[model samples]
Every structure is written in structure tokens, then in C-alpha cells.
Target: MRLYNRDWTRREIEERVGRIDQIGGIQRVRGAEGVEDGVELVRIRTGAGLSFDVIPSRGLDIGMSEFGGVPVGWLAPGGVAHPAYYDAQGEEWLRTAAGGLLMTCGLMNVGNPSEDGGISYGLHGRVHHLPARHVGVEGSWDGDEYEMAVKGTVDETSIFGDHLRLTREIRSRLGENVIRIRDKVENVGYTRAAHMLLYHFNFGFPLMDEHTKIDFPEATLSPREADMQVDGYDSWQSPEKGYDERVYYHRNIRSEDRASVRIRNDRFPAPSGAALPISVELSWDAATLPNLIQWKMPGQGTHVLGLEPANCVVEGRAAERERGTLVFLEPGESRHYELELKVNPGVTAP
Candidate 1:
């Protein structure tokens, strides 16, 4: 495995494709590859459980990245669950999770680009697609495969926009085939305003196909997106019927011992066709991330899944008010949300 550092400019670039200067928040520290294993899963501590290795290989594509011999898909990049377009618009972008993991909290770009979302600010946000400022080198390890881990943070007024203080410790391990997220959010703001925090996990399609299903904790879901708008790719719908804007509200689904859900593509070659499950285990506070969004984009090409745990359901403040999902932090208050993604790989059920 290879080790290095990720600064602030690189921290938020985790959303979508890399735009180091356009990103904010956390950044990456370690990167490596695996010889025996095709996909050298690294141990990255991202609250998003998703990130990109952003390999600037010696002789590879400036956009492509991989430390050793690991599968590009694993370290490639993941996407959020929603289409940037909501109201006949395009995809939107918020502040990303950083560490070159590639993230944007909101839609891709529907009406206008994030730089001009018509909201005075930019489309995604000031730190929507920015990059992180290299802080320091983290660590590297080697075994059957390679594992990489790093650390970065978001200063006040980045993504949170609340003059919030963000600290992230990202770790990626090789061979283990799984990454863990141990994170914390501190509200260093003066006024107590409503906040929305969600992880926009992007998984490659084919890897996400007709066989995929999204599971949740069964809490009273906020509500469906009124604008059953369209996005990229097609979908491998479930056996159920009346599949228009399908959503699930759960309570115990987030329990560590809960059933797993996934977004698998029958055309893809992962575990089986629509067989691999993407499950969520609750930690921190299950009630906060009560609502889970399941989206399917099949034929659009580059299929992916977004398992979002939002503080607010759909309308942010409106959903939070209805679902009572809003979490408040005093002038010096802080809250932490922990989520872990265990790749069943070939295991249909976990």
C-alpha cells in the first residue's frame, strides 16, 4: 500500500469528479494497490463510507488513479443517490466529503451549473466541488493486499456554511475489502440554525443493476420527491409493482442486526443479478438518519446507488419539522454520526 497526505483544498473535492480547488471539507492521506486481489479495498475513515483514490499514476490518465494493482472501480469514485436535476433542472452539488473521495451533497446540475444555481451563492455551494489543502501524510500498510488511511478537516463556513468546524480522520485499508467511517461534526457557530448533513455514496453501475434493493430502518420516511424527475441511467426495478417514486421508511433497518438492501444490476457482474445487498447498521443516533432514499438508474449507463442518511427527510427544514429530524447544536455544540459499509462482495445476504 502507499501512504501520503490530503490538505484542505482536496478535502471537499470528493464529490463528483475531482476539482481540487472546487472542493472543501476532508481529504485523503493513504493510497495503494493489491497484487493478489483485483480490488484492493482500502480502509478509509470517511463519514461517507465512500471515497476515490484519485490515482495520479506515473503513466496513467491524469484523471485515473490506483496505488498498486487494485481494481480501479473500488478506488475510482462513487456518486450521490439523486440526480442533480430535480425540477426539470440538472444535477446539483453541495460541499463534498473530501479526501478526493469525490462527493457533492446535492443534485448534479438541473437548471444551471452549481456556479450559478440562481441562489446568489454558486450552484453546489462555495465549497461545492472544491479541493482540499494537503495537511499531512497519514499511514500505509501491506498484507495480502494494500490498505490506505489519511486525515483532513473542513474549517468554518465551508459546506456546513454555519462557520462549522469539521475534523475528519480518513483511513483506507487494502485486502480487507471494506472501509470504515469514524467521524464527528462540531458546530462552532453562534446562532442555532437548522442543518442538513447526508452522505452521497456513489457506486459504479453494472455493479449497481436490476438486482439492487435499498433497505432502511423503518422510521416514518419524510415523503417522496414531488418531482419524480429523471436522472441518468435506467433501473432494475424490484418484483413489486406501482414503482413510481418508490421510497421506504424504517426504524430498525439501521440496527446492526438488520436486513441488508442493495442496488445491483443484473447486467453487472458483482455477486449475482440484483442479488448483492447494501445494508445499513445504526450507530451514533439512528433517529437522526431515520429516512433512507433508494434510487434506481439503469439504462442511463454508469449505474450507481446512494444510501443516504439525512438529518432532514426531503425538504430539509420542512421534512425535519415533519419528521422531527432536525438536530440542534449550541454555540459550542457538536454531534457525531457513524456509518460502516461492509462489502458482501459475493455474499447475497449479510
Candidate 2:
């Protein structure tokens, strides 16, 4: 296995460490306090300077993530609150959004709040706030390669309403600064159900600042609001007070099978006292996730850059239905989505 920039045999590495976990492994923990009480957390550590937390109690979504002791994921002020605090009404979902590394946005709806078929739908969706069952976590070696993974199933179903089940698996290697998320959404009920999915990948400072640059394949960019159409769509700035959030939809992404968006910062101070060019790339299956949403909000106390990939836009389910863009899943039907997030510790600034 490769660790700390060198190849080593199991015997040699084991001799130097008291326990394998001291180098890299998985540990299960529980949040104990106020909003985070009783939250189950699966902490993963890769010897290659990558670490993250996976919350099974919160739809098996990823929370804090770091590379080389530097935060690669943006954290909301309230932190990872317990799912019990989730409010599924109108805009109240933001209270417990917990803006983490990855937030799974849907099953029945994704976007604004609205009324559909005499039923009121909330802001994003209930998927992120749903608890997972049959959660599993493991770390094993596969012929010189150490692999760590966590799996869970989250169901969004009522008595006779939508019965959608999302089976998610998040995996990483011992010597890699990468995380791969695989999800399968299935309509397990007898009737057809509406489906909308989005993966919200948020990035914040000091990884995102004025020196950061975003790169992606050529695509048609459409601002969510007409007045939001301005310059600097590929650059960033420091946190500004009272700055309004701007969202843009990228359509017709030019990629063969998958599309990737990269954010790079040229002047990130490393733990080694060096200014390293840090880069993080998010890639997804373009065929399944056909659209990308760029959420630029460099506002004070809310500074974040959201690189979201989804099947539907954030304009809400009703608007999607009206535009003939809503997706539906029939009984026993399933859809698969794949995503990878990789961190490059050192890169030549372009």
C-alpha cells in the first residue's frame, strides 16, 4: 500500500504503528449536545491527508471534509443538527440545512416550496433530513490497497404516498484524497412517483477566495434571475456584507460521458508553511445528472460556492412540471447516479 508518499508492505507499516487505525481507518461516533445530540457519525481517515465525516442519521450525507488539515467543505453556522430539528415547511428548511460537503436534495421534490396535487411541498426536499436504515461501515485491504466505505438506505415514503428508497455508498481509499459517492434511487411502491435529485457540493474559504478560479466544460450559462447576469462567472471574491446570492444554470455541458467542474486556489497556506495551489474537482455522470447549478454567495457569514449537479432545477417542482422537465419513476424502476470528489494538494497555478 502507498502512504505518506511511499509504498510499504503491511508487515512494515504494522511494525511502526501500534494499531492500524493510528495510520488510517474508520471510527464510529455519536454527537452529544444540543442540536447534534444522538447523531450517528462515521469518521474516515486516509493516510494521504484526507479525512471526512459521514452522517448516517442524516440520509447518509457527508459533512465535514478536510485535506491536509485544511477544510475542503463549507460548514453552516448551526453545524450538523439532528434530523429531529428538521422543519419541512416553506423556507424553514434552511434552519437545519447544515451546509456540509454533500447534501442529497431529493426524491419527490428539489427546489422552491410549492403546492402540487393538493399537497404542499417544502423547500429543497426531505431526503437530507431523513434517517437511514441498515447502515454499514467497513475498512478492509484488497491486495495492497486499503478501502474504506459506508453504506445506508434512506426511504422517503408515507402510507400511500411516494415510496422512494435511496441506497447510497460512499467510498475512499487509504492513500487517495478522493471520495466516490454512488446512489441508486428506486420506486419501491406500486404507483408512479415524481423524482428530482441533486448533489449539493459546497466549498468555502480559505479554499475559496479571490484567488480561486472555477473551470468547467463549455456550456450555456443562464442566470436564475435576469438582473444576476453580470461578469465574473468563473471567479470569486472575499465575503461581502449584504451581498445577494446569485445562481446560474449550466446546460448542454460538452462532455463525452461525464462532466467535471474544478475549483482551484493558488495561495492556500499549507500546514508545511508553504503556499500550495489547492484544487478540488467534482465530476458526475452527465447522462444521469444533465444539469449543473452554480450557487455563488460570497456574502458575510454565508460565504459559500455551491457546485450542484441535478436532474431538475431549483425553481421548485411545480415550475418543473409546468416546463415539462419533471422526472417520474414508475413501480420497480430505478435510476443510478455516480459522483467523485478529488482533492489535489499541489497544482501549478495557471
Candidate 3:
């Protein structure tokens, strides 16, 4: 039975393979006792229960996500940190912010930390602690369905400066709970490259407490603090212990061309109740992510909620190049980003 060198005759080494039923697959974990201990995860089990954790070093974000067993995201207790402890400056990347489910902030810069011509950006960029080259994992069997993915390529170079390149792809199926992300940000170098991206998506504790609810489409919630107080942007709060985090900026109302957002938790009773309520959807493409940030942290163990999808406007990178809305990338040009994360269990809410 020759496998790697090719030739295998004897009726092809007594061929009789037949055991294809895999509903899901892709496992290549390491350290931290099962998935985080110096980080290097890739555990994606779809089978139907839906699982996640693909931190190819780091830039391949997405740290935690589960379905039937609960906990749809949010991890940051400093859980998955290895990227050699990344810390470009200012807030120290929230001390290895692993508040995941998907956190791929930017390619060059995104949100708060200013300084431009003199260079000083920090606080959301660095492409989530960059690292991810090659890193692959693909599974197939489409006739009966059972697709799986996880590809990578992050590269935000800098010698003379800025050379960008990020080709990520994370898909899933096989009793799908859904999670498809495809990015491609090239500008392989020569000039023109400002590009900023965001896709934070974080939620915790039974999909966030206090009867979570947030379904926006006809937006315009702005309130990044101008004496902030939007009166419960979408309502949710219960983890108090010194809470103080609120940043909203949705501006949707596109009316068409794909753009959805939801985060319901009717009462959170899935498993035993046999799929009760529990929702989560964030489809995208309003002409390539048109900005929507809303990170309201309730506090306590830092309960999370940060469904951000952006292309710019977290106000850094010189205030997005003085509000011209900074988003360059042309020197070979390349930009494409599609995201979808649905996990509806017995859905509700028309």
C-alpha cells in the first residue's frame, strides 16, 4: 500500500474504500490543554453541533464558538495569546483580546490611536497580531453536502512600509450552523494602501444577557460618545461591576443589496428544550462592508457584544484620512470581502 510515493498496483493496492459519511471534520490542535496554550488551533467540527477555533497563529482570528452546548463566542480572559504577545501600543491590543468568534480588525489601520503622517497608529490594526501563511484545511463531498474550510495568508509587510496581502477563507457546513467568511485584500506593494477593515463579532453568556435583542436594518444609531446616551441602543445590560464601554455607529438603511444583522436570544433554551430560541446572523455586502460598529460591554467578567462590520470609521488612521473615509488599495488593487454567520436555532423575530 504505497501512499506518498504514488505507484500502488495489485488492483490499486486491493482497492475497496467505502466509509464516507463524515458530517464534519478538520482538527489540528495543540497546547493549552485542547486548544489554547501557546495557541495553534484549527478545531472545526460541524457534525451539526457546530464548533469553532481557528487561530492559525493568530491572524486567522475566530477563537470560540459553540452551539448546542451554548457559548456562541466571547473568550478574552487573555485566553489565546501567542503571537509572541503582540502589543503594538495603546491599550496593548486589549491585552491579547481574544474576545472572539471572529476579530480581524484591519490590514493597515482601524479605529482610535491617531497620528498619521508621522505614523503612530495602534488599537485595532496589526491585523489581529498577524500570522497566517499557507495554513490550510479543506474538506469536501458536495453531492450530499459536508463542506468545510479554513484557508489563510495574512501578510501586512513593512520594510519601506505597507505591502498588504490577506487571503482568508473560513467556511463550514455539514449540519450547518453557518459561518462563512471570505476575504482577499491585496495591494502587493508599490504604493497606495490605507485599507482598514473590521469584523469583530463578539457575544457572550448565553448569547449575552438581559434578554438580548438587536436587529437593525434601518439604522442610524450613532453615539460614539458625544455625551453618549442613546437610551438602550438595542437594550441589554446585567453584568455590572464597573462597566463602562459603549460605542455604537450603525448607519445602514441601504434597502437592498445584502446587509442583515441580528442578535436575538428570545430566552436562550436550546439543548434540553430541544432547540428553543437563540439567534445570531450577520450577513454582509452593502457594497463591501459599509461600516457598523456597536461594542457595548456590560462589564463584570467583561460581558461582551461587539458586532462590528466595517471598512473604516472607528476614527483613527488620522481620522480616516480627515474623513475622506480612508480606504485605499490600488497598486495592483484587490479587495473582496463577504461574511455570513448564521446560527439560528428554532428562529423567531420576523
Best by lDDT: 2
- Quote each prediction's TM-score: 0.54, 0.98, 0.34
Assess candidate 2 and give its TM-score to the true structure. Answer: 0.98
For model 3 the TM-score comes to 0.34
Supply candidate 2's per-residue lDDT for 347. 75
* Model 1 ranges off by over 4 Å: 1-130, 140-147, 156-161, 213-288, 318-324
**Better model by TM-score, 1 or 2?**
2
Candidate 1 local lDDT, 235-341, one digit each (tens):
44423343343333333344543233343322333223343334322223454454455434332332334445545433433434455655666777776655554
Those runs of model 3 whose alpha carbons end farther than 4 Å from true positions after fitting are: 1-23, 26-48, 51-66, 69-103, 111-135, 138-149, 155-161, 165-199, 202-223, 230-266, 271-313, 320-350
Compose the digit string of candidate 2's lDDT tens values, residues 1-350: 87778898777877899987988899999999989999999999998988999999899998998887888889999889999999999988899998889988988889899788888889989999999999989998777788899998999999968899999999999888889999999999999899999998899888888999999667888999988855888899988989988999998888889999999888887888788987888999999999999999999989999999999999999999999999999999999999999888787354
Candidate 3's clash total is: 2
Ranking according to TM-score, highest score first: 2, 1, 3
- What order do you get sorting by lDDT, best first? 2, 3, 1
Question: lDDT of each model, Cα atoms only?
Answer: 0.36, 0.90, 0.79
Better of 1 and 2 by lDDT: 2
